[model samples]
Target: MKVVAIGGGTGLSNLLRGLKKEVGNRIEDLSAIVTVADSGGSTGRLRKAYHIPAPGDIRNCLVALSESEEIIQRLFQYRFKGGELDGHSFGNLFLVSLMDITGSFISAINVASQILRTKGEIIPATTEDIHLWAEFSNGEVVEGEENITEYGKTSKAKIVRVWIEPPDAKPPIDAIAKVQSADLIIFGPGSLYTSIVPNMLIEDIKEAVEFSNAVKVFVVNAMTQPGETDSYTAYDHIEAFLRTTNLSKIDITILNTKMPSDVVLRRYIEQGQEPVIPDVAKIARKGITVYAEDLIGESQDFIRHDPDRLTEVILRAVSHALS
Candidate 1:
């Protein structure tokens, strides 16, 4: 199977971890299309200082697919403490250095992949240094990925639309080719606005996905994002995808049917987030297949998709689609 997963952040990385395990020898090719519009923390700082696409998300995805030793992975993920480099990750810095030396972001990623012995490839949605901008329903316009999320949380208005700064930014040909040749294309398990949707903001990517013959699956976030999808349900997430991109319908929609315990739920509720209700009937009414399962898992008081369970659900969906 040729699998192509799209999105960024921890969600995509988490999914990749299980995907690498599940696909094992079955995958003919695997690729990840990551969003580079991030302008937060280490990624943001690097983007501003070096005029490069954010490497944070790419670094995470690379580690997720890495076939290297556990200690090597830990080293790549290690963050500096108590210095000018305090919050920066070693992997991000290493990637930046490679970009400088290789004189191409794509080349740097390839070198890093070789070093990590990654099971698959990782490609940025676009090679350009792009910033994400959003227009709130309140008629307020915000620039920067981090700023948009922060403003959304406090603004009285919902996010109306989001777009990349260049507006004409095109995804790399490699990214488009991967999507075009994919057997299965997965969309999120990530933030609706910042992580996943940003990739679709690129015109080329959106068009490529729309025209692809792959079995498209959208993995709905297990929990509502405080600033992005505050009160959104499963159907609302799909609605956002349709409204934002040229893609008309998702073939299969994966929903987490189980909820976390109250203790874990309370922590998220305190942060103004809640479990995303799986409105199966409403979703299926759109002529889409709804695959609901107990995909939630709690770790360190954080609720996330149980990677193994998620992998199983995805494989089953693809198998059914093929049959």
Candidate 2:
């Protein structure tokens, strides 16, 4: 199976980690198309200074796919405690430095992957330096991925549309080709608006996905994101994708059946978040096959999708699709 996972941040990274362990032997090709619209924290600083795409998500994905020594991975993930480089990750700086030396972001990533002995390929959705812009229903426009999330939280209106700057920004050819050739295309398990949707905002990437012959799967989030997806249900998540992209339908939608413990639920509720209700009927009405399962797992009191369980479910789905 040639699997292509799309999205950004920890969700995509975690998914890659599990897939690396489960499907690496079965499939020789696994590629991740990560969003690069981030404009906050260390990534933002590096982007501004060097005029390059965000490297934070790429670094995370590289480390997740790494098969190197434990110390190498730890060192790559190390963040400075305090000083001028406070909150900056060693991996991010290393990638940026490689970009400077190689004169190409893609080349820099290739070098980093070799250094980490990564199991699969990691590709950015676009090589251009881009920023995300969101327009709310109330006519408020927020620029930058970081600002869009923060602004969406306090706004009374819902996001009407989102696009990338330089509306004609081209996606990396390799990214589009990977989607065109993928046997399975996965979306989400990340922030809906900022992380996942930003990649779709690119015309070529979205078009390739819509036209792909692969079984398209969307991994619904276990919990609602406070700023971006407040009060969003499983059906709402799918609807948002349909509304934003030219894709007519998704083949399968994976919904988490288990809820967190009361204590964990309480903690999330306190933070203005709640478990995403699996509205199976509504989602099924859209002609999507709903695969509901006990996919929830806790990590340090934080509710997350169990990586191993998720991989199992996905593999089963792929088998069923093929059979």
Off by over 4 Å in 2: none
Q: Which ten contiguous residues of candidate 2 have the minimum total lDDT?
A: 20-29
Q: After superposition, how far is residue 154 of candidate 1 from its true place, in Å?
A: 1.6
- Candidate 1 per-residue C-alpha lDDT over 1-323 given as tens digits, one digit per residue, 9 for 90 to 100: 99999999999999999899855576778899999999999989999999999999999999999999999899889999987999999999999999999999999999999999999999999999999999998899999989999998887478989889898987889999999999999999998999999999899899889999999999999999977898999999999988987578789999998978888889889999989999999999999999999998767577999888898899898899899
**Could you give candidate 2's per-residue lDDT for residues 1-323 as a string of tens digits?**
89999999889998898899855476668999999999989999998998899999999999999999989999989999899999899999999999999999999999999999998899999999999999988899999988888887777468878888978889888998899999999997999989998888889998999999999999999999877888999999989977876578789999998978888899889988999999999999988888999997776577888888998898788779878
List, in order, the clash count of every candidate structure. 0, 0
True-vs-predicted CA distance for residue 147, candidate 2, Å: 0.5
> For model 1, what is the alpha-carbon lDDT of residue 223?
93
Which parts of model 1 are misplaced by more than 4 Å?
none
What TM-score would every model get versus the actual structure? Answer: 0.98, 0.97
Per TM-score, the best of the predicted structures is 1
lDDT of model 2 at position 234: 96
